[model samples]
Target: MSRENSLVSAQWVEEHLDDQNVVLIEVDEDTSSYDKGHIRGAIKLDWTTDLQDQVRRDFLNKEQFEALLSSHGVGNDHTVVLYGGNNNWFAAYAYWYFKLYGHQDVKLLDGGRKKWELDSRELTDEVPDRAATTYVAQEQDRSIRAFRDEVVAAIGSHNLVDVRSPDEYAGRLLAPAHLPQEQSQRAGHVPTSVNVPWSKNANDDGTFKSDEELQKLYAEVGFDESKDTIALCRIGERSSLTWFVLQELLGKKNVKNYDGSWTEYGSLVGVPIALGDEPGQADGKSA
Candidate 1:
């Protein structure tokens, strides 16, 4: 029984426990979570260490970033399957990064590892000791990612999506968790961004809403789904979740995740933003 357009079930993964091509990468806030208990044969990749190649602040160096993937046994040929032992937080981050670096086949474990454990799936505490494989990371695709400068430049050129909540998009709210800052850096959003909360796509169980619901939901926000949309959140992780849904699920033509997200935008001096019912919100020129 094939899932609509998703990956295998934990039951199916259990049966294919020995399939060589199926490489499971359990990405959690801490890689040690993988050492505690995970799918019997999964590999542990901590979000900070393996997934992100942090610069002095929060930037990624292309060369160094590519090297990390090769060291993690994630080569171009590998059918990389990513799941988060934690909430889908960092798993979506890694999933987005893998695709940006040119690995088209990388797939997120639908519903994440939580769904698997809830079913009493088999797990192992012992860490797998496989030799790291080499991956030749292709040049990063600049199109699928957006930085502060790019967002500023593309203000009116293309569709910019603010995947954060209404408050955050308006600069009225600080972060998704709503942490306050003393300095109060760059407050608004990209000039042309439209508010489309990334969390709106998921149900209470954290699974994606039905495609029909998503279609109407996206359309309600002034998105066509067929057009190119660049989604951004606090740090790009949440928006990546949207990217996965749009590109892989909705079969969108040119959906990109602004991995730099609000962390990069909100700090910049002039990017433009909206509050409540502004004249030009991310929904193109206001409602």
Candidate 2:
């Protein structure tokens, strides 16, 4: 997917608010943010509950996803526009899910809620009521997803991007500073993975950086765009943004999001784990 098709500006969203072919949805890190106020006519999807499987660590299956979207009045042909707080981290996560389920037309609201609020755009608590439709979701697409084994196999062969903070990359912190330091049993990152924090992809206003800027940012980190890439964070939300940057915006074909990420990898039995800031040796020792 290209930037023109995968991203929409807030102004574009505002103009399309009344378009029957468009569906505006909000998915936020703070689940309560949508209840307070959102773009008029926008619907809320609780990332923690709606998208996740309550019984397992994975996402909702095809039938479940279909039911959920159908209940929300999303038709198969509608264009989905997702936006949210925290620089659209969770929204990007939702975007990944939509792609995984083979949604033909989906896009992110550039800059998301943070930029909208910064520009003093109008927000409302009122929710729109629409009739439900039959929404059929395709089978999961494995192309954009990376499993734990693929992450381990890509140690030195492919580009494994550790999209966590510097401290987290060095094993000084388990999760983002704002989040509780918990989840994985181990602390360090995957062996031979480059440290490129996901926040670098965005501007201070929460909008994504230009393609040229993003290309330079990744290039400076020794990123080889030609090789297969797996992007990961503690639980994969942050890395989804990076995955979007590499695959959708930058137009790379071999990029995947390792959704299990550090939480699953770090807890595994006897996998190589690297510590310190540098991309350590494949043997798992600090460089």
Best by lDDT: 2
After superposing candidate 2, which stretches have Cα over 4 Å from the reference?
A: 182-184
> What is model 2's C-alpha RMSD?
1.0
Tens-place lDDT per residue, model 1, 83-201, is 88444667877877776677756766766778777877778886666656666766777767766676666666666777777877777776755344543556556666777777787
Clashes of 1: 4
The alpha-carbon deviation from the true structure for residue 179 of candidate 1, after best TM-score superposition, in angstroms, is: 6.3
Please give each candidate's TM-score: 0.84, 0.98
Q: Score each candidate by Cα lDDT.
A: 0.69, 0.93
TM-score of 2: 0.98
TM-score of candidate 1 relative to the true fold: 0.84
Clashing pairs in 2: none
Tens digits of per-residue lDDT, candidate 2, 185-212, equal 8999998999999989999999999999
The predictions' CA RMSDs to the true structure, in order, are 3.5, 1.0
